[model samples]
Target: MPNFKLTISDIKGKSVSKELKDSDANPLLGLQLGNETDASIVGLSGKLKLTGGSDKSGVPMRNDVHGSARKKILLSKGVGLQDAETGQRKRKLMRGNTVSEEIYQVNCKFNGELPVEAPAEETTEEKAEEKKE
Candidate 1:
């Protein structure tokens, strides 16, 4: 019953957002950072690697942290800490690497091309009806 908002990034630096709910998001449960999963569940043609994610409260997940709980760790330069001065460190609350129900946004890297859906062709009946008008 986990709901996840996925941020999928490709090699070209373009990013796409997708939302998965209930059973569609179950496959991502318990996955950790850097772990790869099949992207077909999300309609992508390649592999999708877990990069990072944030909980419902906006706390980020750090790769070095294990388990699925949140912790206050001393971070100088990493996923949670940004724009720090030289030799500066701070204890920031960040989530663990594992994906859990609390996680709201999941960041992923896609290894293949996105599928392009073809347009539906009009049937002869529809074409004939249009011609009559």
Candidate 2:
């Protein structure tokens, strides 16, 4: 059950989209191909810009959120399936769904966050030069 087309871009770009189908085995939907995630526009608040889906051996689990600003996410269905006619392929029961469950289509976006760097404060002349060594 893979048919997701979720897009949410906020940071001034203002964007919103949603479509989902679940089978419940969530491996981040095998996130692949030009992947980027930090989704959370379902109700709007913070976090938008992401991607991930297609891992029934259909390949495309290219995870690359090299930058994280995840504002909470949780989806399921993508660990194993494909053998409706001896197509052979199984091994995904971390929770359930698999007797014939192969439907994936995820398109995502929720642009924002992941660029944090603020932790450098030592100005007492370097703390008295480390207490004069």
Candidate 3:
């Protein structure tokens, strides 16, 4: 059997080169970049596992608590969480209560032939058979 190794890099030119040895039982290796950057794999084959890794601060990755109202309140304000049943307006911790937005759009141009159209649907009338002679 042949051995497999790979080198993956991000758009910022920062790269991580890894060599897979038969002795290295762990088939998966993880690399974490900053929040603003993304890792992209190019020109390699075997199996690919691109995952978000540990934080740069050396702390373990945290699971998303999207449904927790307390977590949402804490994130929205720098103060402690509020009573869930109180129904009180939060004091905007930060200067502004605005949220920053980032948008990504991809546009590509291809000169290849158009894709083949799918076969037309057949109605019940079209499928009805003529009376045999």
Residues 24-43, candidate 1, lDDT per residue (tens digit)? 99999999999999998898
lDDT of each: 0.92, 0.40, 0.28
> For model 2, how does the per-residue alpha-carbon lDDT over 1-133 read when each residue is reduced to its tens digit?
4445454445565554556556332434543435444443244445443344432444333233222222112223332333333344443322211112342434355555323348898899999989999
Residue 76 displacement (Å), model 3: 24
Give the lDDT of residue 53 in candidate 3.
25
- Per residue, candidate 3 scores C-alpha lDDT tens digits across 28-93 of 322211221121122233323332222222222222422111222234322233353444455322
1 against 2, candidate with superior lDDT = 1
For every model shown, what is its TM-score relative to the native structure? 0.84, 0.23, 0.18
Roughly what TM-score does model 1 have, to 2 decimal places?
Answer: 0.84
Q: What is the total number of backbone clashes in candidate 1? A: 0
Model 1: CA > 4 A from native: 115-133
